[model samples]
Target: MAIFAKRALLSTGWANNLRVEIEGGRIAALHAETSAQTDDVSVDTLLPALANLHSHAFQRAMAGMTEYRMAGRDSFWTWRDLMYRFTTHLTPDQIQKIASLVYMEMQEAGYASVGEFHYLHHQPDGSPYDRLAELSDRIMAAAVETRIGLTHLPVLYSYAGVGKKPLETGQARFGNDVDRFCMLVDQAKDALGNLPEDCRVGIAPHSLRATCSGDLARVLATHGEGPVHIHIAEQPKEVSEVMAGLGARPVEWLLDNVHVDANWCLIHATHMTEDETQAMAASGAVAGLCPVTEANLGDGPFNGPTFLNAGGSFGVGSDSNVLISLTEELRTLEYSQRLRDLARNVMVVGEGSVGQTLYCGAAKGGAQALGRDAGVIAKGKLADLIAIDCQNPALCALTSEQLFDGLVFSAKDEVVTDVWSAGRHQVRGGRHVARDQIVSNYQRTMADLLAKL
Candidate 1:
């Protein structure tokens, strides 16, 4: 496959008139200052596809169902209660349908890969599936159907709260003792063997509140080197709970106890103090920020400036799947910072455009978190690429320098015209190749699931 772009965002920076050659799903060569070959497919603007560093694929079906005031005061906990009610009846086939739609949307939204933080493990009756990897296999099948890169993190959710609290009724489907969880991990890895070559399996100790320190250490010690992810400090209540239970903040506990490094992705480190933020940046771990979802859940502002000043790497996720727009995620990140700091371009690093900085940060950190060789337009990297619609009136005047800013801030739907994930043209003309079938399956699944609920 040979692709020529009038202008493209390269790892080195923006370049003009470049061609990318893909061989064996990797970029074999990049020719700059070049004209399109007769055999090349030409486009206007191109970007490296970003990894969606956190996701709950099944949650996509419940996007707008929980918008009402469930109680006097709504919080993440309350929202989670509703989520539990919804997932209580999900069958493996329903999960597969929902996941297919979600991954397809991710590719169309410019996310090449997903770090699926999966925890839905058992039957609604709390019985283990005949195949322990039943749900995990479904997620991998969705990735195969959608042609999206997958790094499945089978989550170990042992407790309902901090300090080894017993699993609540609503969480029965998620429970796994350490031994069973390890077996689940191994089974999930075996399941991936039948999927795409780029698919991977990892371990996620659900959160500090769910996994004890001993089990956390055990999983880290036994699980071979792969990406490790965990929910952390996403709300003030979570921070308060961690402080009371562990005598330290969640990030603080991880820093003090675990050997934090590039392989770890701390999802939603939203309530960090300056010191914790600085330490996290220095630890080389990626902070997985789901800006749109955080805002939707009313999670407080993260200290983005402090973290960035300390040279933190962060990636974006569609967390709740309430909204799935890569541009909106980047826009929400910058807009949230501006709202917090009461200043414009608060997320801009040095002289780079805020959009460019956000995209690059997410790209690099997401690939690191997913343990995939992507997130850059370079030789030998996966051909996970997106082409922008330069003919969009909003982007008509954008120079190669302003292209990212224009797209991130202004252009809306249909702005991205094409996408290739691992050299597969999964999206073209702003729609997934399997969009109709995926949506139809999802609609039927939702009808059945909701009717039961």
Candidate 2:
């Protein structure tokens, strides 16, 4: 496939009248000052699409159902109770439908890849499915139908909380001993035979509270070379629990014990101290920030300045699927930092465009977290890319340097006109090619699910 762009953000910098060539799911060549061919896809602007480095695809169905003011002092713990109850009624088919909708929205929003932190592994009663990787296979099926690059991170969730608490009834479907979890991971990896070559499996140890040190080490030992994600320091209560049970804060404990490197992605490190933030940045692990969901769940703002000053790498994700706008994800991240520090342009590394820094920095960091050889429009990289219509009202009259700023802060995702995942042109004219069927199936599935609820 050949894509001729009037303007494109290459890794080095922006250039005009460039043609990008893709072969074997990777960028094969680039020609400058190029003319568009009759069969080439012409675009106003092109950029490297980002990977959503942290997601719980099944949670997309629970978007607006948890907003009621229930009882005293609503908190993340209280929200978890409601979420746990909702998970019990989901079937494998329903899961697939919801995931399809989520992945479709992601592609439409200019994301070419996702890191699915999947944990709903068994029947509602906690028994393993006839195929141990049934749910994993369903997730893979959704990715296949949507044509999105996937890093399936099957979670090893052994305990309900810190101190190895026994699994609650609502948490049954997510539980697995170390041995069973490893087997499930292996089965999940084996089931990826039909997916695109860019699709692969990773491992997630749900949280420090969900698994002890010994079990975490065991699971990590098995998956030696892929991405590893975990939840950490999203709430003050969680921080207290990890401290009380594990004798250290979540990030501190993990950095002290585990050989955390570029392969690790610590999700929601929102409550770290200065020391912990510096240490985490020095370790080369990416901080997987989900600004929209963190705001929805009342999780505190990440210490962005501290982390960034320490040379940290970070990326944004649409966690909880409450909202899947890549524009909003980057906007909310920067806005959160501003609200915290009472300053403008707080997310930038230096005295340049905040939009470019946030957008490009996230692309690079998210690619690393998902183990994807993407994040930049460059030769020989995976052809994960998006094209935008600069003539859109939100972007009209903007200078080339200010284009990303407009996209990030001023535009919704509608400005996105095309998306290519590993050279697969699945989204065009700002819609996924399979949008109608996926939306129809999701609506039917939700109607049935709501009736059961």
Candidate 3:
């Protein structure tokens, strides 16, 4: 058991100099400012850690690798081909090393948990390993080593596209039929058993382009109780293909086909109409926004104000992981909104600070999307928290709301001084405790991968 007093900020509001008690990796009690502290108590300003609602951990290795334009047009489709080629060379051990570094970076950036949208399964030859969940086990092991709360989402990739076309050679490793996918999910559950109790297993259908309607239905039927995430309408071409092939837009078809609710997350719904945006908002599903990746891929801006007004929810992700920072993601999100609408504070509601509004909304929506009890500093919740350096030049002279504004708008990841996940200290003084070794290993792995490439 341990107790710490701080200016605690809850998602609902704030309390000054509060005492938080922890036991067995969960919050036991929270006391307001007047509470007395014992001699052994420690105090700091505590804020609930952010959840990275979507990530492809392995993609961290491919950062900046595809920047140069090819002879043909460079777009998300072209970039994906490069990604597919890159995935072929990675062994499970290499994946573990890369994911450890990725998770470490996430922890340092004020994210205590990550929802890994894992789709890499099978060997490079498209054959199952002796242990079907070898790749997933590697991810779980990395999560344990990094102490980041993980929601491992095993993806089901049945077909090449909506019409159940055969997978291209590059996609073979991620391909799995319905029965095999169900078994893989079971295997993934067993693989995650070695991880902390807070680690969870969820389901992901890779995208509208990767799974047929029948297969998608089957996978969802098999894992209906767990969180369901899918890539949807990320590009104009994808929207056109879905419309031509399925007679409906991606989100429209999804809402018409699936029983989407709070349990569902539609990643990269970047190219939606106003009606589609409003309908998605009314469906109680989360928009898994990845602003940096969207910008990187030249995907268009999301209709933020309209969606929010329609009662939509959104959570950010470090997709592609060219850069990883919660503040950067939020900043890019707001900046994108400003660029599109030509207005500032475009996402804030009545009587709310822009930064506070963004933070609270992302936190709550991310928690809901990942099916985790996080994003708030409350009793009975997992003790995943971050402490920013209030004394930093960007944060100095800022009140609670202003602090958030400055942190989001002015500061970067360097301001995140301390971090804890599931009541375990993983980062202190703005660095991961195992930063040196993790970085060294990651460097070695990247060198080897590059040598082979």
User: Largest TM-score belongs to which candidate?
Assistant: 2
Strongest candidate by lDDT: 2
Which sequence of candidate numbers ranks them by lDDT, best first? 2, 1, 3
Arrange candidates by TM-score, descending: 2, 1, 3
lDDT of 2: 0.94
Give the whole-model CA lDDT for all candidates, comma-separated. Answer: 0.90, 0.94, 0.87
Q: Which ranges of candidate 2 are over 4 A from the true structure?
A: none
What's the number of clashes in each of the models? 0, 0, 0
Please report how far candidate 1 places residue 246 from its true position, in Å. Answer: 0.9
RMSD of each: 1.1, 0.8, 1.5
> lDDT tens digits, residues 347-386, model 2?
8766888899889989999999999999999999999999
| Candidate 3 per-residue lDDT over residues 342-378, each given as its tens digit | 8888987656788977877888888888887877889
Quote the lDDT for 160 in model 1: 84
Local accuracy of candidate 1 as per-residue lDDT tens digits, 4-65: 99988887877889999999889999999999989898988888989999999999888988
Using all chains and alpha carbons, the TM-scores for the candidates as numbered come to 0.98, 0.99, 0.97
